[model samples]
Target: MAYKPPTRAGATVYVWSNYSLQERDRRWKAVRESGAKAGFDCIFVPLGDGIDARYLTQLRCSSVVLPTDGRPPIIIADRSSSNTWAPEPWQTSREWSEPMAEALLELGMERARIGVAGLKGGRVSHVTSIDGVVNHGAFAAVMRRLPNARFEEATDILGFARYIKSAEEIASMRKAVEIAEAGLAELAAAARSGVDAAALYARVMARMLELGAEYFPWALTLGMSDGSDAKRFTDPPLGRRLKANSLAQTEMIAVFGTQIAEEDQAVLLGPIPEAWKPVVARQREIFDEGVKLLTPGRSCAELLEFSKSVAEKGGMKAKVRLVGRGAGDDGPVIGAMTQPDALKELTVEKNTLWLWRPTVTGADGKTRFTWGGTVLVTEKDGELLSKRAHGAISVA
Candidate 1:
């Protein structure tokens, strides 16, 4: 259903999310000091990736702002003929642009200042259009509708707003971390000689679902390293089998509600190699050192430099994939896979979530070892979210 934009005298901000209605409400509250009531005249909900009319309806019904005449802000959404669910009378099933134009015109906002999602550095996923596509068409359509309207990219507004986690968001992330730990435990238990990558992946996925995980960002990636002088990683779990006396490297992410927890583990199918022991120890040390520095107000650049120092002191070359990243919604990524200077300006803040991953290249150059888990930044220190031990899990 569509409504004319309100005659309210504040700028309208359009945004979307894959999170629940309650989470979206919290985000809206963060976006404006007056909260949802005076934040904007309307919100544009996108239809895609499990977001449907029912979900939008719930958002509208629950997002009532009592201070403002007890009326909720107008919610606009689009529907297509291909939508499997029946459209609510209050929702617009027309191609997204048409309804957006109507709403703007009705609100007498044909020539007003507006903030669209992804105007800055935010993600387009926050503003998907009909047909589940996020592209220039939606923005172009709105431009056509309100030619005189001044549009601005408001990406960082939402990014910084979501930087700190609410108590509810933290709780969801904690549960998500627990679920990920369970999945890792399952992987460790099932990792052994003669087991194929696919089988191990299946086992962990089943356990995660059984433990109430709703969704996962990516499939489990499992590979084998035989202490050879060669870099190795694998494609999606195929039929590759774990060999005796080899290390099984596994990466998995588990989700609860929309929060995510990531775990990367190395399991030894047999005896650990003498050559690999020092490599593993140094990787652990680097991770520990980095974790200790995850205190509030610490610059990501500082932490990265410290991490590099730790690796250098151990006579290893650091190939940092991710020092960490914002964990809840669209990530305000930190660190670098290639450039060390990336995200140097962003500092750690309390109540923020991150995945601290550090990888080190051995003296041999070809051998690389890596490991880490999700962490929550507190006022004093960063709390490790995953329950598993940091080093390689040895399964004899």
Candidate 2:
């Protein structure tokens, strides 16, 4: 019997999860190198969405014990369904702790130095979290079981490795950008005085998933504010509809397979007040100038400072966070507010993906503007992946 690929109503669709074995090896090589450099014999990963778990084992929806010796990771899936998603010849279980410790012991790693992921905030710059996201019960269980093993913080082993995009990762990110643009286009076309903002968001989500977004990100940030308040994003009160003069915006993230791309979406429901036009224009100018600095080797601090100075000179305050990593797990999220010392010293690297959402608020504070896109840092320069904004989607 032949396995026929699934299709939707006689239409052609591209499968977005294709990554070559070599690409997988390339990622593994990075993890191995990072571990070896850190003197880690194994890395203990707990339950997470498709993060390092996906990068190393492809079955990280559960937990993983990745031996630094190039051996396949030992997995404990959150559900039995994970078994279907992982490649063959590997085993999965719903149990944790006992099974996990057993794998390390079997590998003669009970006394080996192990790196514990989620121990502290190393994924999105150690600045974002004073303490990393870790499951204490899981850690305690292992501590009790593997009494002789040593543990150390190992988040960077995966963080730095994920920062560099492989050829396949870039392709998937591009596709995610395409899917996001498709949704943005639909949202723009759907925007009008009478539509419900929530309804509009529903449409956007449907379209993205139809085009192959992995799932509906439940925590999507979207909002609509009517005149004078200048609130960029908010859920409309029940039964309220978009007024003729309104601003609808979203902090959108589109996921394709494990890759992601993000953008700031805005739709103007009516004409801007005469006084606000120049302020908006100046905001756009700041964005235009700031984005050019996305090239590799550019300093994150320098870019943020440039944005602040330009925005201030142009009559607005630059957003505290200018950009965020936009790939699997979306880490190293930088901003002055969270971790200033480290963010200011970071450098943008080639092939690193990002979502640049540069925003500014006018002197009155209510007159705000945002123009953003997902871009890839290339050897030559920053390549824009999203093509949805020419400022904001205007209905008037």
The C-alpha lDDT values of all candidates are 0.56, 0.66
lDDT of each residue in 1-396, candidate 1, tens digit only: 245332333222222223555665565555543223334333333222122122323222111111112334344433211111212322443345565566556655566555443333343122223132224675577678778876554444445665677777688788878888888788787777887767777777889988877645444434445545223343335647777756665567777655667778777777666666778787887787777888899876676666555556456776544433333334444444324444546788898888777777677765567787888898899888878666777788
For TM-score, the strongest prediction is: 2
lDDT of 2 at 64: 66
Residue 313 miss distance in model 2 (angstroms): 1.5
Off by over 4 Å in 1: 1-25, 34-71, 77-94, 123-133, 217-223, 227-236, 321-329, 336-345
Query: What TM-score, over all chains together, does every model reach?
Result: 0.76, 0.85
RMSD of each: 7.4, 6.3
Per-residue CA lDDT of model 2 for 1-396, tens digit only, reads 111222222322233435667776787778777887899998777654236666655543556677788887656544332332344312344345665566667667878999877677764533355566666776678788778888888887878888888888888888888887887788778878787867876777888898888763522233343335443333333454676767766666688757777777667777656655666677677666656887889877676566456646545565634555644445545444544465655788899887776666776766667667777888978888876556666786
lDDT of 1 at 48: 26
The lDDT, on a scale of 0 to 1, for candidate 1 is 0.56
CA error at residue 374 for candidate 1, angstroms: 1.0
Name the candidate that leads on lDDT: 2
Model 1 lDDT-worst window of ten: 60-69
- In candidate 1 the C-alpha lDDT for residue 308 amounts to 53
